[model samples]
Target chain A: MWQPSIAPDAVDRIACVGAGVIGGGWVAHFLARGHRVTAWDPAPDAEDRLRRLVDAAWPALEALGLADGAARDRLTVVGTLEEAVADAEFVQESAPEDLALKSDLLARVDAAAPAGVVIGSSTSGYRMTDMQRAAAHPERLVVGHPFNPPYLVPLVEVAGGESTHPAAVAWAEEFYTLAGKTVIVLDREVPGFIANRLQEALWREALHMLAAGEATVAQIETAVTAGPGLRWPFHGPCSTFHLAGGEGGMAHALDHFGLENPWSRLAGPALTGDLRDTLVTGAAQVTAGRSTTDLIAERDRRLIAVLRALREAQA
Target chain B: MWQPSIAPDAVDRIACVGAGVIGGGWVAHFLARGHRVTAWDPAPDAEDRLRRLVDAAWPALEALGLADGAARDRLTVVGTLEEAVADAEFVQESAPEDLALKSDLLARVDAAAPAGVVIGSSTSGYRMTDMQRAAAHPERLVVGHPFNPPYLVPLVEVAGGESTHPAAVAWAEEFYTLAGKTVIVLDREVPGFIANRLQEALWREALHMLAAGEATVAQIETAVTAGPGLRWPFHGPCSTFHLAGGEGGMAHALDHFGLENPWSRLAGPALTGDLRDTLVTGAAQVTAGRSTTDLIAERDRRLIAVLRALREAQA
Candidate 1:
């Protein structure tokens, strides 16, 4: 990990290591944001694969309206990792999640990357601390976890390793936001990061249901898409449950049924300062600065609209 | 549980017992659908509460274009359960999820309702088998599990007890679909039902994250609304993972990082004959007779549209 000599906002060139599905996705996203991308991979067919992934994604990107001058033509696949980072303003590593392999690869990138260039790993599960152990300049390495199809899904969980400078974490968060991602900057590491932890939990329950023959895979899925999933995009589980509490809101919800609620069998995160600010700010952003009252109204309006739409479509 | 002498599609009168939050919501939904609703509850203020709920939900329902002749005036809250069910074509029990209480209430409804009428419990967790144990006509009793705010959420998990007639299960499926609800017809019972199990799982992981101080209530939340939550409305976890496999589909996803994937520590439901058909049928409904190829294209198109809308709104 290298520190950035240039300001995060001024980062115009991105170096992508590992030109696979995710790596290609990152490249496509950067290109869509009107940035030059230098990508490198060990596989000989990496360029071909990367091109295809980007091509497949371009129409959708076009549908989203690319930034001025954004085009697939801006991508440059270099021969090696060193060449990819030679003149890069920022580096994003999308290598496999194998800890040893990642740590080794990240160390080499650290050796080659310009000092203070700021390297972010796309590993979903690894703590930046574990992955940064082998890096000579670990302070610049940070985790910038993106969801699948990076060009589409907007969340990027940003965190720094133990040795990493907090400034770098802040810088990665800023850079990702500037690149048009909903950035979640973590002050500490958690296995599976934030999203996956939640996902794994829901998935765990899903597995239990499956193993017990409680429901079919399809049943579990519809339980989501048609039910809770409809509310999820606009409100997190907490906020949704808060809505479920009716006019009483969240506190009453907790007091009445949420806390020690039958489902206490499931786990959750502690409520606190930074996470609170993150949630509040993220929520404000999500709702476009609408008040909770305004949001509640919008959610109901949208839900009714969607419900009507689905009923009509499926009827 | 009672069986309907009338055709499932011919049922125009609905009886809702225990008019609290869930029952009130059911009343609102049935009212919105143009059905003459007869509701009863032990609470003295039940009529006022149910009227308020239907009134509050009316504008949204109106925006969706109410069915012909649909009006809030159609709802009739009676003084007794027997009076409520005397002329009802179907009975929906939304009592609290107390096992013995629900069993007794359902049994009473079975005795009071018109012969051959179907009785459905809106219990979230109790297995239909357990709840039907007290009923003399358990064959007509079915679990009509619904998501919270049942009037707004389109999903309703319909299942039959061990003694329940398969015809009754089919009848409930047709009935709910006609009522403009997406119904998952299950042959057996699973505690927490399917949706709650999935919800509890995700919630469990969220709790773990909290217990460890991994993140805050808000962080765990935004992580969803902004990330996986966006995809969930359009795709279930399985379909989402299938797409995540990048052309490899569900099988490749299972083989690579999914089967024994660290996240496997999470659980799910088992696949079976009737349940399998539900899954497939649900998938088909979710896609609205669209091919997988068409679905992929539609998903990408919609994702890009949502991403663009979010960026513009949040900007």
Candidate 2:
């Protein structure tokens, strides 16, 4: 068991297991928020890669007005999981998404750590119940799935298993909130949680449209980015309906266009084999003559700038 | 029958029927793009309302760097549907979303317009097949559904029916493009088209979650706007998948997390009754003590600024 030396108001310490992309992102986020982070990964060059990833992300993070020296000074590398989670208040596990491997690793962490330490699994798959079943103390396990490049984005889904204690949930929420994240509590375990489910529905339709030769990938992408996608972030579906009703709210909108749902084509199956191939091919075609890496980098840079401007305006 | 003043660079004109919110929006858009507009509506204050709407939207259009006095000077409100479509190149029908009313009005416009004039219906309901079947010149009929506040948002889905001529489709695309609007053509007539379908899928799940006591409406709305909704506008579902895959792209992301789809709480019926009531009440609760009219105006103003900034950045 571990002992707490730091005051409650002092910066909390975070331990990250598996310094891959997600784990590296956790390091960046916690470090940026002035939390001391001890990271453990078996990969030979894990430390170097994590450092490089953080370095590469600095420009974008700084563009978002989040760069700070305290974040850089708080990062450390460790070889063993026990050492990483030794006295840490929060532990983030981002190992491979395999169930057995994660369960085994988490069980070890739970055994070594104190009862108060919150163990958050960054698994996008497997509900919290199944993953925490092997933990020595299942009450401390929680699902804290963060979006990619967690330091740049601010969404973290805080889900609890049946065995997870309410204190653990509150602690997880509080922890992420301090790290500049928007925490959403999932009432129960559900697959893909919230974001991914909505994403898949849209992706599936886009793929079907491509498969049916309805429109090219470029056209479909342009349609979304220039159309609905532009307004979606500011106004969700319900608000859109309210606006559509023209002062009558959603009920009026529904009364006017509710019957149209029956005529919509929502019967497409999952994107398997050839359909998936077509979608990939279409995306490539749409992005022809442009390097995806370069495109992504440019996009990231612009996004950071836009977010920064919005934040400054809000401030 | 109308006669075309045959010229190589003849100016295109649009006839707008029903000077309500949508019709007024269309007038603002067309007028802002230098398209002469002939508008007609039986509402007593239709002209005054349309003029006010145009005046209100002018700053936003100018902020987009696409508005000019030359375009604004071209608007002209006519006396009747006969005069509105008499000599115009295109007729935009924004009549109420009633089938019988729309069919009757469309038939009248068809009778008054030239033989080759394209009659585009801005109906969110009533597929092209249903609308065209009622027209005398079915070949000239097509659906040009635009989202709310069409003058500010630039997405128009141009769907053709079985009887719609290929020339009409091409002409409509060119027309919208010239007017600085992004046009997407649908493969077949799908109700709500592409955007609304994806939107409804997400909305259904959100409503279900609220109904099941998973979260309050305010929480759900907060989760969306502050979380995934933040990234959606800049990066769509597919692009987000690419990032989620840790630079490997959507395929890898799908392989890793695709299994979660089967377990998600999606695939539920649309929300109704109590749930719908809860959403409205929740929205009111969250928006209590706030003026919606002021909020809308502020949102519109921000949208205009963002679009202008983006345009300038692109240039």
Candidate 3:
């Protein structure tokens, strides 16, 4: 097992590649934690858009509280990928989900960063085993997946590729934790990891209902926000069922509810033309004439409020 | 079409046919809403268990806010199901999942209740089409499914079967809304209804992961409460993806991320002996030897805190 060249809490320089939504989120998060962040993206307007995204997210971070020296100006936009990682103690790549592009980009980052520095990919779908194939120092490659609006949401899933050292995975987990994140480290690689698999299952089920015309889009949204979604923020599906079993807990739940039920018979529906139109129309009805920009502002507002509420509740 | 004999807002006397967890929760909910509740269950000690359940739930209800004149003494446990429904303005059946048992019980309640007083079944699994088979007055028998801890969680999924009247379905929706619930009325009968289908999909996916040894129970639980679960309380799967697509919304999300992919391949796993053992053991690890009763108390406490937080956030 390889050892981390730099300790997790002592590191102050974070390099971020690809400043789109996810990459820019990482930049904002690292800066808020009082780190010097170097960000690089190929788009001509990447610096402008990245700054705007960070500026939009600042109020929420401020409400959440910043580190001793944290400030947005600590971020430096670099001209090239090599310059970005030239002095970075750690590197995070948030490139597009294309496998070839990610693999090639990770290889370049791996070559430029100091030897033994861990490199994490933010590819939501591809496995690190696949992405690390072209990297020279593959042992240091790991996946550290974060939810959208990473500057706010506390979860980050960390796992290593086949060639990754156990120490590297542990180091990444420690780094995330010290930087104020709740990390889940997987024992072995699983496609889509854990949360995404569970999420996609629900998403696919919703689509099936929409395609079959069994429920309206608004009903689907209400079925969640007004229903199980409330419990989810505190209790997960497993623990929720455990309580449903009464005093007997999960064993009683499994035995009492049985396994082969009608609900389990759901399969992913093929998204056809008619289904696509239904989803588009249904979503429009739910959107209720609000533009995406307007909705984002609303979502961020509510998210910050909810996060503060959760924090107070936990306290 | 059958019209509601009594107006939704005028419902004050409610008959509950079963007094287990779900049934007892209904008792607590209605009692807090200032309704006189009459309940019957066949269990020898059901009264003791039912009252205790309501008492345990009372503090949470009190935190949520009680309707004027609401009191625990307003609940009356009767000797027979027929007596329970005799003078009721509305009847809610929270019977066991056995087809024959529920069918015969609904038939009995039907023979005894005042005419046109709508009856709703809290069956988590059975379709109303099947459950209403033996009821004499099936048109008034609609499904009104609730999440566990029905009082605190504001969602109630309302739907009707093949023989039920559309007017009765509307009446139930209006009543639930007036009595403090967010209702989702399905246009047609769908097995397991809406929320349960979505919940079961996620449950099965978590089980699949557990069975495959890809993640631990703690990891699964943390994966949710820390990750997507935080977002779910306000936003849902569809709207979330809409935001994930950036300024383009749902249509762009669908186009950018193709329909069929690795995540869509999820299917229900068989509950083999080894898998069951793993689940039980993993759950034990999560419980950490805490008694089920202890866990329930903790769950209730946290749930109340979260409900209060959400309320304050919304305000």
Candidate 4:
């Protein structure tokens, strides 16, 4: 078992290979943490796009008490992947979700970066093995899958493949911790890692509920957000059961509800053919007239405000 | 198709059938809403227990801006269910989770309460059909499931069986809305109804992960409370997916991950006998050395404070 350890020094240097939404988030997160970030993307006008994203993210980061002059001074825009990764202690790869493109980029990064640099992939789907195979030093590659807008959210799942160096894993965990992220180390390689896997399960069941006519999309969303969603932030399922058991704990609650599991239609077998169409239609109907961009921006703003309040309270 | 209407005025008079933890919560909620509450429970010292629960709940109610001297003056202790329900506008049944006992109590309540009184069950499990079958006027019985400590939590799931009266449903909805709850009307009857159904699905998956050794108990809790749990309070799974799709919608994200669903093992198959034991053990180990009573009290205190702050800010 590999234990996680954090370095005592401040993380002042960072690099990112892509500057899309996820990559832009990585840049914002590092810059918010007072790390100088160098980023490169193949898209035309990538620097302009990245600067716009940074500007959009600034208020939220500042609201969270993270973005400041010292942190802002560390940001650097680079023209190429080599320029981005060179001399960086930590690198985050957020290239497009293509195995071939990601593998090729890892090979290039391996050649350009120093041996001690930790390369973390932001790929939500691909395993570490897929990207590490192209790297000259496979041990240095790890997956540091972060939720969207890495600066506002606190979870970063750190995973490693068979060839991923234990030291690299430790370094990646430490770096994220110093970046003010709560890191979870994956015991082994798994697709979607941890968060997405749990989310997919929830989405699958939610779609099934919509399809079966049990509840409308609006009611379902309202039920979750107003109910379980309220408590989930403070307690996960298991702790919920512990509390539900009254004085007995999870064992009692499980014994009481355990038998009901098989009887309840949890998830539809699987989505096939037209069932997929039904899901899309249901989702569209539910979210009709709602602006995704507006919602994201609103959610990000609220998150930063809440986190900022909590941080201030702690201080 | 039923459209969700505005909640009715707070019940002027409430009759509580049992005074356990859940029953006591009902007393606190109704009383805090300025209803004259008549509470009855066979358990020895039930009144004392109910009083302690209410005293503890006062801070939470005050935080929600619902606790006032006038609101607190409306509570009345009674010797029997008959006395409690007599001439009441709304009767909230929160008896122990025994089907036969609930049926017997509802039967007696039907005999005693006025014909126009709406009877709501604060049950987390029993189906409305079963509870109503024992009532002389089954049409008056409806499910009004509230989360723990009804005085603080704002969610109230209003569901009715086939035999339940439409008028009763409307009345229950109105009453809950007046008391400041986000009411979700379930069109069809289902075990655990909507909120618990979603919760159970998530819990089942979390247990499977713990049982499979994919993640430790602490990691799983951290993964949620610090990760998606952070955002879920404001944006649910569908909303999150909508954001994940960037400019697109859930459809875009679904198309991207549709294939991965089949390939990924999000959660192990429903937990079996021994796996159930492992899950319980893991939860206990995770919460080891912590007193649940203290935790519950602390959680209640914090929830009250947070909700109060939000309410004050809104004001």
* Candidate 2 structure quality by residue, lDDT tens digits, A27-73: 88777666788999999999998997776655445544553455675
Error of model 1, residue A125, in angstroms: 0.8
Off by over 4 Å in 3: A266-315, B267-315
Q: Which candidate is the best by DockQ?
A: 1
Candidate 1 positional error at A183, Å: 1.3
- Which model, 1 or 2, shows the larger DockQ? 1
Q: What is the interface RMSD of each candidate, in Å?
A: 4.2, 13.2, 12.9, 12.8
Candidate 3 chain A least-lDDT 10 residues: A295-304
True contacts kept of 4: 0.36
lDDT per residue for candidate 4 within A44-131, as digits (tens), equals 9888878877876766666556744546556788778899888877789998788898989988997898767778999886788877
Please give, for residues A1-315, the per-residue lDDT of candidate 3 as tens digits. 566789998899999999998899899899989999999999999999999888877766675679999999899998999999999989999998888999999999999999868898887857899999998889999999998767766788898999898889999999999988899988888878888888888877777676566765667677887778877775677666656666655555655775556774554243344433433343344345445334333332333344445445447
TM-score of 1: 0.88
Model 2: lDDT equals: 0.66
Candidate 4 lDDT over B250-281, as tens digits, reads 44555454434332343334333443333233
**Which stretches of model 1 miss by more than 4 angstroms?**
A1-3, A258-296, A305-315, B1-3, B259-296, B305-315
Per-residue error (Å), model 2, residue A115:
2.8
Task: Give per-residue CA lDDT, model 1, range B1-315, as digits (tens).
Answer: 334598977878999998887998899889888899999999888799888777877887787678887889998889999999998899999987578899999989988987788889998777888888888789889989887678778899998989888878988999999998999987567676778777867765765565556777767777997788877876887677556555555545454654343542354344344434444444445446554445666677666555544444444
lDDT per residue, candidate 3, B37-106, as tens digits? 9999999999999898787777667755799999999999999988999999999999887777888888
The predictions' CA RMSDs to the true structure, in order, are 4.5, 13.2, 13.0, 12.9
The collision pairs in model 3 are: none
List, residue by residue over A186-257, the lDDT tens digit for candidate 1.
867876789987886776676556555666777878889888887777678767655655565554444455
